[model samples]
Target chain A: MSTIALPHQERGASFWRLVELVGCYVLGLLWIMPLLYAVWMAIHPPEYEVRFDLFAPLTLDNFIAAWSAAPFARYFFNTFVLISVILVAQFVICTLAAYAFARYEFKGKTVIFMLILLQLMVMPEVLLVENYRTMVRLGLVDTVLAMGLPYMASAFGIFLLRQAFLTVPKELDDAARVEGAGSVGVLLRVYVPLARPVYVAYGLVSVSYHWNNLLWPLVITNSVSTRPLTVGLQVFASPDQGVQWSIISAAALMTSAPLLIAFLLFQRQFVQSFMRAGIK
Target chain B: MSKLSRLQSQATPWLLLLPAAVLLATFTHIPAVTTFINSFYTTPRGARPARFVGVEQYQSMLADPVFLAALKNNAIYALGTVPLAIGLSLLMAIIVNSSIRGRALLRMSFFLPTVLPMIAVANIWLFFYTPGYGLFDQILANFGFSSTNWLGSPNTALPSLMLLGIWKEAGFFMIFYLAALQQISPSLAEAAALEGASRWYYFRRIVFPLLMPTTLFVLVNALINSFRLIDHVIVMTRGGPDNASTLLLYYIYNTAFRFWDTAYASALTMVLLAALAAFSFIQFGILDRKVHYK
Candidate 1:
């Protein structure tokens, strides 16, 4: 209803606009207030102490302390490696699976698809004990590869990518076949690029989710080298050392920086993907 | 469908499916079997070799006070977090749906909490709930309201965590509503408006009906999340305040890691799977109803 707003008086629009802007500022500040406080605490020393003193100097002391508190670099690297390995593995596996389900008509299709969707409901974390035993049996405890293996074939990703692939015209596949391409070539050439947005959307959602996930990683990874940032951040955050609030906040800010920055940068896309993720 | 032509016609699809099937079977299916098996076993420590005990773990787990407390807390936590988050998000979506200026900014601000790591937000909320110099306390003190032990009080701990859960998840649920809002034709609203219908009336009849499917989806996710989410408890409460915040998954975590009783933990996991199965059944039923209603 463009008409609903258009014929309205300029006064009404201006009043609402002013209200909206004020609301935006207040809500935005409220939303990001914790992170801002973390920045303040992380940069300032303990003596400053919540005194509303804006003029206090900043330093790298908290960062350095937080850095030395654990294998922050290795944790960061592990998280990066874990995301990459899982993303690539999930993309390839889910792509093929999605292609088959999207393009082929076969017996047990509904049954198999239903089973795959069951994983979405029974999230692996809920079955942690059994999965842990499996990992131990495979002698993959405390390894990044083990951390990534369970998620190598994601039901959610397959569902999303299959929905994407199904949107491609069958005429394109026929043309590709006419042009001397096999089924594999048709998938690579015709479907993948057309589904680039879905890939980006799925990839962003996956990376952000796995980046923030802690439970599964905690169950699987014991050593520092395999520990992701979220789990490591916990070791700093979950201590009985009388609660070093500032340093802990500092570590948390560091841990969440990547996903937060990505959200800030691609706010619209992030929101859109989240909407898609929700609906699916 | 084609045993004779299976080698020729069925080769490609099965080939494509091999990797995913293998992984899902190994990781998901195999663990399912282990879950069924382990629930029947007894192990002294997680390190010790286990022996079959035939539902002894389940029987003991049922009688265990700690397990009962955890289940109670989980019920309250689930009941608390899901409804409030969905309700608030629906409200937020309605507000954003208005031709409000700076809607994009407000939307982004609302969604900021979802992007932060659960532990990070839990840590921040933990500090805010901390006794003194905390945000909640500081604001309360300034307003002449003496600070309450938000997370420390047994009565308040689960609610406090539920509050955090709502704050973190409402924006997430909002996006889904927003998307659904976009798809509702403006003409429908206009036609109702032309009938001299009040905004409330129009929304009651038109918008709510249109949003039924999205609501179902949100509800399913919220239910799943109440069980699936363990990170927040690990950071925020550690199932504390006399086990007031103890959730099912968090209890399983304690059984496996803290108590070091792998058999009991496996039994606890089976309970979680049962909860999840119930949730899935409800979700599917709701989805079917929504489709029929639509």
Candidate 2:
């Protein structure tokens, strides 16, 4: 249907529309100002770190200084391993549990599912004291495994995969069975493949989350070897070290560059995956 | 099916569920129960065994001024952040959802913070809030304003942290609102236009009502995040300047790890758990009703 309108109405609407566009642009610039500032500081010399000079000669010295200032290579390795372990474990454990919940009829299914769902509200982070004590008892404290263990079986992962699996037609299950595939085979060939999109979405969320996670790892790990980038950066930037804006900005950007670069390159997929994941 | 196959069928779900059940019970359920129990006992010293305190830790928590300050600060932080972030998020979503120029760039700018680590963001903001030569001070100096200790002062510390929280979260919440707005049919807007309803009136009467479920969902998330998003506090403030910016979770962290007062930390944790439980009840209640209505 055509929207026939008077000239006055059109003018009024266009005026408000112009106002909104300007407001959005201003807000957008404000929102991105911090990152822009980081970029400027990281690329500029120490004396020009805070100064907004259009013609300041940029140098790679900040990045070089930031790299040599700390054990950043070890920190990056630890973070990579931490997220990898957590994501792999989450995929395995959640897939099995979600497959069961989607396909099986078992005793106490409702009660068990309710119990599992309780983790949604009461995350392991909330039980830090007890979890730390448990880690101590198991002699797993100060280990990367300790950093990844508590989050390996994620409620959110299970819930998302369960939703994905439920949408897979039972006809496929029966067909796989008739083709001499067992239950595990059907899940491997059918359910897992069908849930690839959910896996990608969950993987991105979980990776970003565990990569950025600091508190638990900080509480549990005491040494440089096991420390992730977040905790390492915190220690590096602690006021005891004295403030050096250029190097600090460079260090911050270095720690966050992987995900930042990924987001920049695959901006559409990153946002669309989150939207498709239906995380709200 | 054969008897053996029937037996296998009965055991299959249990077997499939075993790994998840073990991990969840170990980390979530058992820790939760132990946290409650641990709160009732005194922390064991190096050479001494633990002893039952019988709610003394809770009593001490009631009297501890730091705990009280952290709790109050958390309340203020929540008050400052939740509504403002949600409102800004909704506004952003509406702006981006319209046929605006550079919508993709706008959405990306808003969503970039969601991908970056909070610890890193806090570091960037540390530079911004640094006195004298900081980014904020540099800009303020251009206008003939003096440098302010944004992170070091008691007055501005928590509010500075609140600003960080809002910047980080508004875009995340906007995604949900954008998703919800996309689901809304264009006919609603057309119909509202035909009725000569102003845009504000249309949004208030029609769009807002239609977005109730998303609003509720975002509210629950914001509530959880108010307690959970303490990473920046750890990095930027360390709950410093006489505990001005100390949040509930950060306080519990400090009490437990830094001070080695596990019992008192357990008590503080119980308070956090109770708040989460209350919000969870509200979330599930509203979510169930939303499902039923649908």
Candidate 3:
């Protein structure tokens, strides 16, 4: 920290600073170029896809074509249902488990907690073969339930909620208990309300994750009615469809629009939520 | 407390933990054990119900060329992507955290890729990598280089995917770095400035050490993600050009679903589980010593 900055170093620093700023912007532009290009190609006619012209007429025919080409509405509905089921279940299940871990001392608590945390490593994604077998035995193949079941008890969610619940002061719990609130009542009145921000953070992360998740859903769902947007997009853009770049780009954008729009609208919260989820 | 209350207290935590326990057991724990157990058996075609093959399946997996290739490809993928993504994310975090113009917009651009589905990002990059008229070709044409088959050729296939991996992941990691950066006191920078210390000198000696925990955290995630990368492969290449881009998990998917070789896929999954277990070891073993838990 005490290295001497010579007289000429000050002048060089400002020059390098400008270069660094410009470099940052340039990299940012490079980072977003693919998405920008997708938007450009999607909005314009097919002929203008490879040829970029500022004066090109923009139309939504690609979107219209994409919409009519597939059962995207049904796919959207399945995705919505899938994510909702997963999110709600995760919230309920993880909250209960997290609460137990945060507030209670019990037998085999450490071992059980460690076993639960193992999910973070050997995720369902890696155990697809056996999980698929499990689904087959359960008679849950091709259903939205199969897609959401494997992910319901999210170790990540439990961990995050536990961290949040631990930060809640014990006095609040005792006060609620003295006021004649039962354990569940205390949890609902004190811990849940106070952990609202963590809930919001966890909810956003969970929704985004399941919404974007493809592999497991693709494996489990055999019908269009159960396929999420990601699987549907893969099927629509598959090589047998003959590489219609414009329509595919539009479909891609459409499939991602809800998340993209939400992210843009609440950029700060989204970023913070991701940050919160990632830390510890 | 009453006797009933004491009894309730003893039972409450287990009751609360029941749902998650059942679900986790059903999905994660049971499946993991079953995957390992099934790896030692045959695929059980028709009436021949899966007879125990012992280490026969393991030996065949050792002999399988594609499995070895996928293993090598995944190693290369993890090696290439993790360090690059971590470095680029740290750089992006630094740039965004500084007193720069349009920091919000810059931050948004970097983080926007993280929000989009990997499948969609692969779709966009698929177009970019298309030969003759793709985005890359158009730019390379300006410099008078002939258009090359990016994903079609075996030599460039995995590297091309790695490029996309870095692009999509850096921003996600950046948020973690940014969070860590904010926790750092500003007075450290101010004191360094007052001492006339060079910015690079301060960053190298002071800031880098402070960011070690975040780096380790991001490193573990990036490594895990590298193995989990099958979406883009499914989207773009499908491990094409003579299985050049075939990652371990992608191969596992292909084996289990496409080839209907569930037994071999279980063996492959065991390999992946082993890799993850190694990372878990690193997380608990090294992370405990290095990461300061404030």
Candidate 4:
């Protein structure tokens, strides 16, 4: 097989390979064009936003202007508190439920698991109207808690942790039991340590998701005190603001920078874990 | 061994599951049922208490032009995005998976959009599509073409949004394809090469069929995404100059919040829920068959 391909590779394959390479490079440039544009527009003065010049003077005026145009500090603080609460709650709730599903057998177990899985397809966002009413009824409307409650019991987290827990060797459970360690102790010491990678992967996904999520937050929180960055950016970028491209781009980059920087720094782990997390 | 211990074990699972089960019931299941029930009631107005009006909201939704347009637009948006995005991502995966120079940079560029928020991407694209002096128009003018209203025009608005959808999602789908591609043994490619099969022929006969499971998984996700990924629509067009890009979920949002028509929004949500349920059924059926095959 190697011999046959060697001759062909010397014949027409190089040309085609070259074409494929060039094609990929072009596509790559096209893919990253928006980000490049954002950087260019964001750093340059408003006049040079649409103009491309290698010698154009760059400034931080856009960022300074965008910062003052909205209460971004409050928005960032709201988003920070929102994602932290949600991630913590998800960890606790999903760990317990996943441990049960992975290790225990009880009546109606299958039925309960199926019910939990149903949320995978029928996400809370689908029933936003009713969820809003539920929030209002609880007097949680316009609060950051309202933004995070629906996502506290995450189906994806439970499923991922359950898979992770199932992979822990039964011998470890028995050894822990022989040492007179309770089930909770076994889970905390053994299973949790074993599932650290899964936890990191799930945590990254959850943080990025809630950070970028806009629609539900927009619908749930109307006050500046509770609005996340995405909603804040949306309000900032409204067309009625007369298309301040430079300032808008600055705000956009500012809001997305944390995730983008983390992704760039942890590219391999981010991609690998996303794959390992079996999002597909 | 003892009856008491057996009883304790029996209660353990349920006790552990209590918090999750309660939260899920409170948020997901209960809200879903309420959404269904609320769809059958009229929106309560000042000095006018809510009353049951079975199927009236649904009837109005049927008669409502905006709802109909949104439904049609969403269907078109899904049809446009799902296949194109899948195909583009597959191509991207194949390209990156092969022995190409600068593959790391290429893969990073492809995956970059997935990291950025839709609102940010929409803002950048808004500048690109801006009339007269936008990046696109500036480039087009270099070729003596007139500037066009990419997002403002009805004919191009939905497609413009679709383009953003594809750009934002194809890289995400590419990661999945890349994972699948890496799993395929290289020996098959050697065998295909021994048979003197061309690259296209090998991909068509060997690579694609081997990727069916991944394709199915990606297809379900893409379908769900078509409904969920209206963030760009909100940021870019806000469903457009004439609701040309109004998707079902976005329409539900407007109906409920902007108009304060909760009952009508619930009715719209019921339709969205029904669509999701159908997709889930299809997914589970396919997944079950795949499991059986395994």
Candidate 5:
């Protein structure tokens, strides 16, 4: 109350509230303009495209055309494999590290943890040159495995899971140990079930990120077979040779549908997951 | 239970860390070392030696106009996106913080751009910018202005990319602010309101100061994304129209793969790494002083 500078006010809540309502409506339309536009283009044929006619005839021709035009099924499969591999690998390895960090006392734990944190700051994108060279040396370039391998050891995931694991009571750990549960048993039976939300949060973040990732896949993959949808969509859309905007939007829709559907289904969890992931 | 040996008993944490350590070492650490090594040598096509050129590549990379231009564009991109997005999100957070109607719907609208993939957003926006068949041009045509080349020109490419980026990222950052706003005590606002404080006055005085910590966090997050987030440019611009939109990461891609200048790319990598570390240090410094963590 003391900090309130009433006389210094330019715009108050009442002013800004109206501003926000107008803002919400205007900006909401702007924010969704691209999606709506894409949907419009995807549904309408060339004659009706961008006519702003309101009564333009719509059809599923774009989807069928886009599907027949590219190896979208294979692209979807590659993206699936790439996402699943990274997700599975991240969970298994990060959980182990997180469990130890959460429960046990160890020498140099902070230093080791700090070292892991270093990679989080210096992402693989920054160090792409050498990574490519290494991949070249190993002949792993253009492989879907190459796409997932770099992100397998996720420091952020470990940090998150560890934070979650620490919330569990030491008494719980003690009880599990006294019950003749080994470290593995305690981790699996006690630590994991409790930290399920963090797991779900991390898994969703990883899936969406990898699902939409383009640059890395673009660099590693060359051919259509090895390409994920993001890169595949790019190749289809890049050179304006013979590609139709309508069909491209359809491909875009197909590429984005799974995550969008997951998001629509689990909107609350998704937002919360992003919040958790961002904070950590 | 039979008691294990002291060595085995003390090995638990180490054992847990081992898997992550191995994978990180293999994937990240090893590749980082390799990128560093490759940066000192010239790995030309059909060349085996990759002659240890010392700092020659570094010197030349420093002199390269394209490299410098990319660095400048990247700086502008960061400057453009970071402050604007954070500020927008802060405003959105403030608005959403109030007992507004359709909170869920508002939040959902704010978050919708985020759910859509960057590539998809770009694709849609690209069409929006498409010369004759696009939305922006169609509007311009209605207004009796000639359609401008949106992404096709070198001058507008980077800024256009920034627009798309800010639109996509504001919601993600808004979520952070919403969370941070939730952390602020509503009683503080009520007390301000009781003191004849207007919403802006309360927000500017009471709320904004309390939100400094969140602002700092958002700034650092935005800065990191601005610097390292070049995935969009790769698909949208490809550092094209005379390398107009080539940020550091995008340039690193070009240097490594397109131009195959691995050594110079290494130096570029180190530069960004240094910038990130310095930015992080600054953030840590601010967080240390201001943030009252619970």
Candidate 6:
């Protein structure tokens, strides 16, 4: 197999490979053009936004302007609280539910699991009208809690953790039980530690999702005190804000900086975890 | 084991599941039911309690021009975004999966858009679509072409949105494809090359069939995304240029919040829910086929 097509085929393949590589590179450039363009507009002064100058003066005034223009400090704090609460709640809730589903022989388990998976298809955002009504009824509207409430019991997290747990050796569970560990202790010790990679994967997915999620957050939060960065950026960048491209670009970048920086810093883990999450 | 211990075991699982079950019921199951129920009623106004109308909204939806336009636009939107996203993502996966130079940078570039919020992306693209002052016009003017209003014109509004959809989504689907590609054994490719099969031919025949399951998974996600993704529409177009870009979810949003027509929004949501249900059914069918393959 190696020698039969070694000489001529190798040359031809390498030629085509070169073409393909160049094609991929061009597409890659086009793919990130928006981000590049945004960064260019953001770091430079407004006069140089459309100007193509190699030695253009750069400034951080746009960031300062964008920050002071909105209550971004409050918005960042709101988003921080929102995602942290949701992540902790999801980890706890999904861990318990997944432990039950993975280890137990309970009645109607399959039925309940199916019901939970329905959320994957019809997310709370899809039922925004009713969910908002529910939030209002519960008197939690316009709060950070409202933004994260629907996502507290995440089906994806439960499913992913359940799959991870099911792969754990039975001997490990029996050993943990033999040590007189309660269900919660066994879960915390055996299942959670064993599923550390899955946790990281789910965590990355969840944080990024809630961070980037706009529609439900946009609909639910009415006050600046509770609005997350996505909603704040939306309000800041809306048509009535009078189209300061550099300022809008700065605001957009500022809101997305944490996740973007984390992604770059942990590029391999981010890609691998996203790949891991997608596999199932 | 004693009877008490057996009983404890029985209660334990339920106890473990209690919190999740309650939260899920509160946010998901109950609201879903309420959305369905509200679809059959009229919106309550000041000094007016809600009245049961029994599918009147659905009947009216059939005659509503905006609803029809949104429905038609969403269909076209789905048709446009899904196949293109799938294809481009597959191409991207194949490129990155190979022993290509600068794979990390390329992969990062491909996936960068997925991390940014859709609203932010729309804000940036909104600038790009600005007439005579935007990226597209600036580039086209280099070729002596006159500036055109991309989003402000009806004919181009939906397509412009579709282009953004494809760009935003292709990288996401690429991750799944890349995962699938990594799982493919290398021996088959060696055998194909030994048999003198061209790269394109090998991809079309051998690789594509092997990727059918991933394709189906990405397809379902893409279909669902077409209905659910209205963030860009909200930020960029707002269903502008005479409702040319009004997606179903966006319309439902406007009906519910802007107009305070909760009942009508519920009815619209029911339609979206029904469509999602249909997509899930397709997913089940695909899952069954995948099982059969295994």
- Provide fnat values for all models in the order shown: 0.62, 0.64, 0.73, 0.64, 0.56, 0.63
lDDT at A216, model 6: 97
Which residue pairs of candidate 5 clash?
A130-B35, B39-B263
Question: lDDT per model, in order?
Answer: 0.83, 0.88, 0.90, 0.88, 0.80, 0.90
lDDT of 4 by residue, A223-266 (tens): 89999999999988998987588999999999998899999999
lDDT of 2 by residue, A1-280 (tens): 1112211256647776567567889999999989988989899998887556899998999999989999999999999999998999999999999999999998899999989988988888888989999999999999999999999989999999999999999999999999999889999999999999899989988988888888889889989999999999988988689958888999999999999999999888787777766654
- Of 1 and 4, the candidate ahead on DockQ is 4
Give the least accurate 10-residue stretch of model 1 chain B, judged by summed lDDT.
B285-294
Q: Which ten residues in a row have the lowest lDDT in candidate 4 chain B?
A: B285-294
lDDT of 3 at A263: 95
Judge candidate 4 at residue A40 and give its lDDT: 92
| TM-score of candidate 2 relative to the true fold | 0.96
Residue by residue across B125-182, what tens digits does model 1's lDDT show? 7888887778888988988988788888898889888888888888889999988988
lDDT of 5 by residue, B212-293 (tens): 7778878887888898777678667788788887888888777777777666778788777778887788687756586654
What DockQ does predicted model 5 obtain? Answer: 0.51
Model 1, range A144-208, lDDT digits (tens) per residue? 88889998899999999999999999999999999999889999999999999888888988898
RMSD (Å) per prediction: 3.0, 2.3, 2.1, 2.2, 3.0, 2.1
DockQ-based class of model 2: medium
lDDT of 3 by residue, B161-248 (tens): 9999999999999999999988877778778777887778888878888888888888888888999868999998999889999999
Most accurate candidate by DockQ: 3
Clashing pairs in 2: none
DockQ of 6: 0.57
Stretches of model 6 off by over 4 angstroms after superposition: A1-16, B290-294
For A1-280, candidate 6 gives per-residue lDDT tens digits of 1111222266647776567667889999999999999999999999987898989998999999999999999999999999999999999999999999999998899999999999899888998898899999999999888999999999999999999999999899999999999888999999899999999999999999999999999999999999999999999898986959999999999999999999999999999999999888
